[model samples]
Target chain A: MGFGGRCFRVQWGPSALRRFRRSGCRTVRLSTVRDSTPGQRRVPRPVDDGDVPSVVALSEGRRHNGRVANQSGGVTHMTLTAVGVDRPGIVAALAAVLEDLGCNLEDSTMSILRGHFAVLLIVAVPDTIGAETVEAALAPAAHRLDLTVAVRPLGELPSLTSNDQTGRSRTVGGAGADLGEGEVYVFSVHGADRPGIVERATRSLLEAGGNILDLSTRLVGPPDAPVYVLHLTVGFPPGSDAAGAADTVRATLGEVGVQVHAEPVEIDVL
Target chain B: MPVRPVLTLPAPVLTCRARPVGSIDDEARALAVDLIDTMKVSPGCVGLAAPQIGVGLRAFVVDVTGHRKAQSCHGTFVLFDPVVDSASDLQPAREGCMSVPDLTGDVRRASQVVVSGIDPQGVRRTLHVDAFEARAVLHEIDHLDGLVFLDRVAGPHAVFPRKVYR
Candidate 1:
């Protein structure tokens, strides 16, 4: 009777087979309506006035859609990336061309990689010149240098200012709290390839509520006698009455058979 | 008027040989104050030579105490007609100038130095310094010798495009 009751949920009666075959015989189109709201959508307004608002707004929207725009000023942010054999006056020639376009050089990082000079620039100009004009202006320099030039309109500029004005505090990388006024200790430990050394020291410091600011570990020594070195700068809570925090860490690490050097860093800058 | 503007690059004054101070008088003291004021506003400046401020005198003001590398350092200094008594082996460091607003270069300098000079009151003094302090002193002294940071750069690779330092 129990087995019969369990089999009742399967609907293995003749009606179940007939319903499945009938459903397969019919055509059904499963379509979905995406919610594309008006306010959420943006329309591209090219630089007519060449003001920052229009240029930034348009370029920024483009960036969110996975595009890079260099438009700044009223004009679009101009960008040129070139890689050519290193020579004198390459930068000079490029700078002069940008200056002629009435373009304001915002930021540029140029370096010689191997035997070639690679340049990346963020330039701005008044909106009076359109994308075509900018392309034409840089063409001569690109030709003279025998370099490739790629131009594009920039999307809006992202807000770079810290957003911690509200009550919520912001931390870099969003994992730990920001550094507070307290004693900072820099600890270095080296031991033969072993387990439980890092774990033991970290657990000891964590129990004492010490915050690690920056930690770096590297492996040295021969493969047969591998050495692991851990260097860490840690922060302690303010007025925690822990004068020998570094020593305490060193002692815990010593039991793990690692040589440790713990010194109080001058925390005046923090 | 207020302190005179410091001469920037291509101004010609920055390359002129600085005249040695015969004595520290009111004029010299006023020039020192001008140098201090000029250094304070020269963006990422830590020192100013008289030649840079357009006075072309062998005097300079250094307050590297405010710099990140010079955070732990002796207080400010006002040296008139400074001369190095001795110097250690050369150590090269990257340096930027207010005159050369958008240029930086690696310049060779003494790792440690002892400088003899006069204060604003004409009182003679000597200082023994090491590391970045010595580098700052050497940079300002180069102005006295009619040398700029560009002149000390070994090659184009030693120079850098300047960026605004926070």
Candidate 2:
């Protein structure tokens, strides 16, 4: 399988499933979106303290066991989510803690909603570091920042397509890959503020064989007839109907928008 | 010039408005060659601003030739103390930077623009460009101004993490 983004790998077995791995080039590539504050990474430094361990450790342990150790090293992946009232330096503060613990910050996203800052991070930590130790390590920063944080060892990776009815959806709902694979597109819907827009619009994209990698919405315009603007980055399987998917989504969102537009995100890696 | 290391986020130099290149001195010429060599060696890299290499100066190199999204390829070129003479037709597109490393954002940029500057040969040139070339030029210019794509993202949700599988 190509490391193209949004390419779907259909699993044939007792239970049918699909996985989303993204890459735009010849090599099998993987990319996760990191939503964080900019320029906070220390001056041109080694990305991981010269350490070379990965989530590959999880492959041998499999599910039903949260603590998996790689024979070469004891590093494994953990999922951490945090949220609290919005404030500056929260990322830097947390980044410092992770660095001190020798944890590698993997995929992540941080966004301010209303007055709250929410972050979902996947980190690789030494297997010796349990969930509680991580929570305790972050306790000081969490308290100082007035944030609520949770860390847990990841079990089996959930199928990328089962968001509607799975725990994976709750933990990392919008933490999907950026569509650099097969075909990438942006589908946006804007109109008077209302409910069910996300549910309805995202449903259509999912139905069109598109994986919703990232999604965000904003309430804009005057207080009266405020506008709700939503943008989605979608990755479709190779050679799939990208334009058709957008048309299907636009048609599905039908007039729920003052304006609805979809276009290919033709990105040149250069 | 050797391929200098790219300075990443939070590097103080990246946010500082670079000094203007008064004239293409030997140092300026070397910086141009370094920028060109660095941009050439990096895969999927189309441009590089002086600040990206930790040089607080107004210089950048861009080469959009052979890119599928490019409409007005400039081949490979460098400009010193460049300035945008005119810019219009703003559109939002996802952008990633070598300095930022781990994220991408939907940045609004002028799809068409007129830019003037001094070439490495110390000769003055004005470029009228559109489409992907315009975007690449604007991106490098922002770096010269000490601004990364994060500073120009559309809104709160326009930023995304760039996941890398090693």
Off by over 4 Å in 1: A1-77, A84-107, A112-117, A123-127, A137-146, A153-270, B1-17, B33-47, B51-54, B63-77, B94-107, B121-128, B143-166
What TM-score would you give candidate 2 relative to the actual structure? 0.58
Instruction: Highest TM-score: give the candidate number.
Output: 2
Write the residue-wise lDDT of candidate 1 on A1-270 in tens digits: 112111011101112222322333210111111111111222232322343232122221222122122332245555666667765556556555555565544545565545567776665555677766777787887788787766666666332211222211121121112223466566889998698877887877877778776566778889999999998767677765444666777788787788988775431100
Residue A141 lDDT in model 1? Answer: 73
Q: Looking at model 1, give its docking quality level.
A: incorrect
lDDT of 1 by residue, B1-166 (tens): 2355655544555656778898888898988888877666544456778887678789988876765666236676789989999999897666766555434566777878999999987899898877777888888898887677776766534554332111
Reference contacts preserved by each model: 0.00, 0.11
Candidate 1, position B94, lDDT = 67
* Model 2 whole-model lDDT (C-alpha atoms): 0.67
Best by lDDT: 2
